[model samples]
Target: MNRKIIFTENAPGAIGYYSQAIASNGLVYTAGQIPLDPQTGEIVSSDFSEQVKQTLNNIESVLVASGTDLSKSIKLTVFITNLSNYPELNAVFKKQFDGIDPPARSVVEVSALPKDVSIEIDCIAAL
Candidate 1:
């Protein structure tokens, strides 16, 4: 199984000992992405909606670096600090997916997340 690491300047750099994403066989698996801005490496905003957007954008960047895009996503696992924000997440997904069939997704409410951010997301997509 051939494997390749994926990276992109359009996304925030990994804060730990991990690549942004990895492509193996015909699939790309991305690391969990927080709401950090790619250029500044800071949380994009304190708002839940903004954090969800930034996290998805980060996942998009990783997928693109792996020769795929968000439309090719097979699945996504979202971690959020508050389950009450699920509606906002769905609203963002509605816009992001638009006319296309959205990927399979799971939204989990955790007690906390890295950087004290409100949300994080990771995806699997076809290469």
Candidate 2:
């Protein structure tokens, strides 16, 4: 299978030893995205809802770099520090996916996340 590493200035740079995403065959697998600002590389906000939105935006950038978009997402796995943010997550999803068919997803509440951010998200999408 052919594979390609993906990167973009529109998203936050990888803070570790990993590419932002990888495209192989016809699908792109993205690394978990935090709520960091692409230019500043700093956490975008302390608000849970804002963090979710920024994380999703970063995921979208990676997807676009891999020649796909959020509408093509096949699956998503969300890691959040608090399950109480569930309602806010769903609300954001409703707005982001609005008319488009949303992808299959799993939300996992964890004790912590990198950078102590409230949330992180990763996705698989067709390219």
Candidate 3:
């Protein structure tokens, strides 16, 4: 199977030992993206909705780098620091995937995440 590492300046560079995404077998597997802005290297928002927007944008960057778009997403895995924010996060998710069918998704509350972000999103996309 052909495979390639994917990276983009539009997303936060990976902080650890992982590429932003990988493309193989006509699919793109994106790393979990936090709310940090690539240009500013800052978590742009504290509000749950805003944070979710930024995280989704980051995920989009990686997906684009791998030659796909949200429309091609097959699955998404969301990690949140608090389940209490699920409603607000859902609102953001709707806005992010606006007018498009969302992929199969899983949401989980995690003990913690890098940089203490409130949310993170990883995706799988068919190219």
Candidate 4:
């Protein structure tokens, strides 16, 4: 089986040793994306919703690089620093995942995340 590493300048580059996404079998799995801006190389915002929006956009870029997109995503994992932001996060997801069945998802509240960002998201998408 052939596996392809996915990368794009539209999203923030990986800070460590990992591809932004990988295509294998029939799916594209993405690394967790935070709110870092590709252009400035900094977290976009401190607000929870803003961070989520940026993270989603970053993940979208990775998916596009893999020749797929969030609309075709099969599963998602959201790591958040605060569960209190869950309702707002759902609103953002509803906006982004609009017109689609919405993928299977697991949201976890973690004590901390890289760069002290509020959220990080990753997904598996179908090609």
Candidate 5:
């Protein structure tokens, strides 16, 4: 199957040598999305909750660019600097995936993220 690169102005561009996402076979694999503003390439907020929301929104933009959406997500991987922020993270996750059954998910704590932001999320979605 041929892979198609996915991109959109609605989401921040990849920082290094990567596309925002790629659609291959029947799935769309997104690069990890931080809370960076698409227009300015700056982290959206210092607050962890705000970071979580923006990250999800960024992922959604990439998905939409690929002709799908968060509701089509099959899996999600979250990177956070603090596991202690789990409750807030789940609250935001629930809000992002409120209607349908949410994606299968994993959360990992990292030593740091690009831009020193608090959270990042990447997902695999059905096309």
Candidate 6:
């Protein structure tokens, strides 16, 4: 099975030893994307909804880099610092996913995330 490492300046540069996403075997696996803006390299907004939007945008960039799109996403894993933000997160998610059939998702509350961000998201997408 041939594999390709995906990278793009449209998403936050990986701070660790990992590619932004990998495309192979008819699938693209994306790294967890936070709310950081790629240009500014800073968390775009502290608000949950805004953060969610930024994260999703980052995810879109990775998908595009891997020659895929959101429609190809098969599953999403969302990790949040607080479950209370679910409503706000859901609202942002709905704005994007509601219009189209989004991939299956699982959301969990974690004690912390990299860079102290409130949310992080990763996904598996078909290419």
Residue 106 shift from truth in candidate 5, angstroms: 0.3
lDDT of model 2, residue 5: 94
Q: Residue 12's C-alpha lDDT in candidate 5?
A: 99
TM-score of each predicted structure versus truth: 0.98, 0.98, 0.96, 0.97, 0.98, 0.97
Superposed by TM-score, candidate 5 places the C-alpha of residue 48 at a distance from the truth, in angstroms, of 0.6
Clashes of 2: 0
Candidate 3: tens digits of C-alpha lDDT, residues 6-102: 9899999999999999899999999999999899888987788888989988988888888888888999999999999999988887877788998
RMSD of each: 0.6, 0.6, 0.8, 0.7, 0.6, 0.8
lDDT tens per residue, model 6, 34-124: 9999998998988888899999999999999898898878999999999998899878888888768978999999999999999999999
What's the CA error at residue 80 for candidate 5, in Å? 0.4
Q: What is the C-alpha lDDT of each candidate?
A: 0.93, 0.95, 0.91, 0.94, 0.94, 0.92
Candidate 5: pairs in clash? none
- What is the overall TM-score of model 3 with all chains considered together? 0.96
Query: lDDT order of candidates, best first?
Result: 2, 5, 4, 1, 6, 3
Residue pairs in candidate 2 whose N, alpha carbon or C atoms collide under 3 angstroms:
none
**Candidate 4's error at 93, in angstroms?**
0.3
Across 1-127, the per-residue lDDT of candidate 5 in tens digits comes to 8999998999998899999999999999999999999999998899999999999999999999999999999999999999999999999988888888988999999999998999989999999
Predicted candidate 3, C-alpha RMSD: 0.8
Deviation from native of the Cα of residue 86 in model 6, angstroms: 0.7
- Predicted structure with the largest lDDT when compared to the true one: 2
Model 4 TM: 0.97
